[model samples]
Target: MNQKQSISYVISSQSSSQQKNYRTKLTAVLNCTRLLLMQELSSRGHDESKESLNKENLIELLNWYVARRKKINEVLFSNAPRNDQMTSPSIHKDLVHCCAVETTRSMINEMGDSLFSILVNESRDNSIKEQMTVVLRFVDKSGHVKERLLGIFHIADTCAQSLKDAIDAMFPTHGLSIFGLRGQGYDEVSNMSGYHSEILERLNIEELSGRTGQF
Candidate 1:
């Protein structure tokens, strides 16, 4: 399905379940509305009205709905966990992240190779050790834009040959092809940019000899 239809389906599925409790139903509605609002806001870029889509307004709506829904639940179950300690955990961040990841995967699937580029970069996160991030930029057959984070690959070593081997494995696993690769981008790394022969050089030699490139 197209993006619009897909987003609608995602929202609809959450609220269409008949087995959900009233509180759960309201929560699903709030989650779906937030996702829809965020999608619209993002598509409009910086031009969207902040006043209308303010986070506070969204939170207030959700809170109001939850309160009303809780009252209804209480009438249905006079003695069913009325204590404050029985409150369900808030899952806003986790739910939003899950939706975002799924949306990205869908976009990538729609973008069936219109020439792409690979960018590899390593950075230290909270653990203070290097981790490699692999990103792909491409366009879909329908001329739609798409960008995907393949994943953060752990750097076993900063060696170029090792990185290249990891990349080769990733590409095949993802059903992506080096044939669609228009360019390879990297900042100067000690091993990849070293004087000693790297993966690029090895591949070049093989290409020159009309043989298949090896990682």
Candidate 2:
């Protein structure tokens, strides 16, 4: 059988007696923990620790879960180098991040060397550190308006220079060139895009320099 068919057969052949394997139990525990974490994060609007959850009777139930869930993360992480192996709900989360990055890169590539604009924004967590995200607005190869989400970035500070550096680091790695960028959309932060902001002006100048070098 092919690899996919082999997996299907293995799954279809699982009898009740074979369901008690450590790997099987580990999978169930991981699924339960994931569901609980999602519910907790949704209800609390942030990440919660086992310590914070220990006050509840549910903690006892989850502790039983923990007993069975041991070593799964280590096994999971050892499986591969993709972001999924390092993250819970690994396959799904990695696919989401990958889609966001790939869709944006594809849109930019279809822009056909025209002037386009990018928007940047930041979201903050409980620790109050800002994480930046970028979006590109462009027309795709089929002449349809498409907006694609770029990847989230780490903003070490709210300063303009830091934002520019982050952009610099992200641009080349995605096969994106800033040569034809015509405008920038930023939040109402004065330091980011104000008239006298050296960082913002420097980005525009960088785009111009890239354009000049293309000719």
Candidate 3:
């Protein structure tokens, strides 16, 4: 039977609660997958906006997929009622947060006790607030080098000390330690490069003191 006929049959055969449950699960999966894809694209320098991934667009994409693939249509739409879609904005936000957490966890796991270097840079946003962005570079278990965007932090100022302090405060939250940092890099702009040298000196002093039991 065609997809529409199959869906009609399933709707008639399935109970309302069953249809709702199927749709809820399917929506959650599709939303999480889409959010992850969008994040990957964004990281690769693709510009994306919420309107591009809005609920209506997602629903249309799902419908198109169902129309093309017999197996996917049978599995996803078989018990899902046409009107029982779950596309709340709040749910989408929650899914996006979940994807972020999962991606960080996976990155950390792949890092696996390896020493990583950090590349740091600062920029002001549209609001004129300075923010520092850090990216971690390391070799995974398979011996391939990888770089992941660790985080972006709002800073009180872009001074060397303030930037160093911000990174010091951030590492522990993710179970990372300055001791694991083998190297650091910063933007080649004169002020930023100065910050890089000062921060490296500070980190070296701290590492020495920690090992030697001296303040």
Candidate 4:
């Protein structure tokens, strides 16, 4: 007839072994307000029956899982800062500040007995306009050699004065001073390496005078 009547009929007609299975237990839960069959299944150590919930409890559990799933979906699709995210350009100020601090520290480390050697080279572009690239090479406090490109400036003339002014401007901008210079060198070109160029001499004198506050 109905689920309750069927469970009752099975329990009365079938052997106890058949009655103990979920078939009967499920029928009883769907039909009977009293859960006597469920309790018997529990006493028998039927794990499925033991873990089973009543209608109200099952509905409550389903609601909880539904709410939990909604929350998880929201979190997954939401715009939030995730792990391993890179800093954007909006925060580049912090990155630039750190670079400045490192530059200052590097200059401080080059303070004592560090050789500041200038290597100047000239190259012409497609327009045949010559440009000078100055490289500052020195040993840091850790005894490891370091070098950096000072600048690459278009030179109106390869004369010592123009190259010197461009090179000199770059030093102070980086919090560096030429007084640390201990050596001078240049490419094979006469304007930089040759005595006739006089650029190297001016650099040496400029550096020396800087040491004594002459400039």
Query: Which candidate tops lDDT?
Result: 3
**Backbone clashes under 3 angstroms, per model:** 0, 0, 0, 0
Tell me the tens digit of each residue's lDDT in model 2 across 104-161. 6666667766556678887786788788888877666677776677777878886778
Residue 166 error, candidate 3, Å: 2.6
TM-scores of all predicted structures: 0.51, 0.50, 0.61, 0.42
Better of 2 and 3 by TM-score: 3
The sequence of per-residue lDDT tens digits that candidate 3 reaches over residues 1-215 is 47656867777887886765676566545654575468553211132243554434444555566677664565454444445434345545566667777878888888989988888899999999999998999998889999999878999988877876887787887888766767667767555555435555654545554543422
Task: Give me the candidate number with maximum TM-score.
Answer: 3
Please give, for residues 1-215, the per-residue lDDT of candidate 4 as tens digits. Answer: 47656857756786765434334333322322123223433211123232455434322332343365643223221222352111222332343445445655665556545657777787888899979887778887777887766556798877767777777776777666666665666666666654576765666665475454422
Q: For each candidate, what is the lDDT?
A: 0.57, 0.59, 0.67, 0.53
lDDT of 4 at 127: 94
Q: What's the lDDT for residue 202 in model 3?
A: 52
Error in Å for residue 75 of model 2:
17
- lDDT for model 1, please: 0.57
Off by over 4 Å in 1: 1-18, 22-65, 68-101, 140-148, 193-197, 201-215
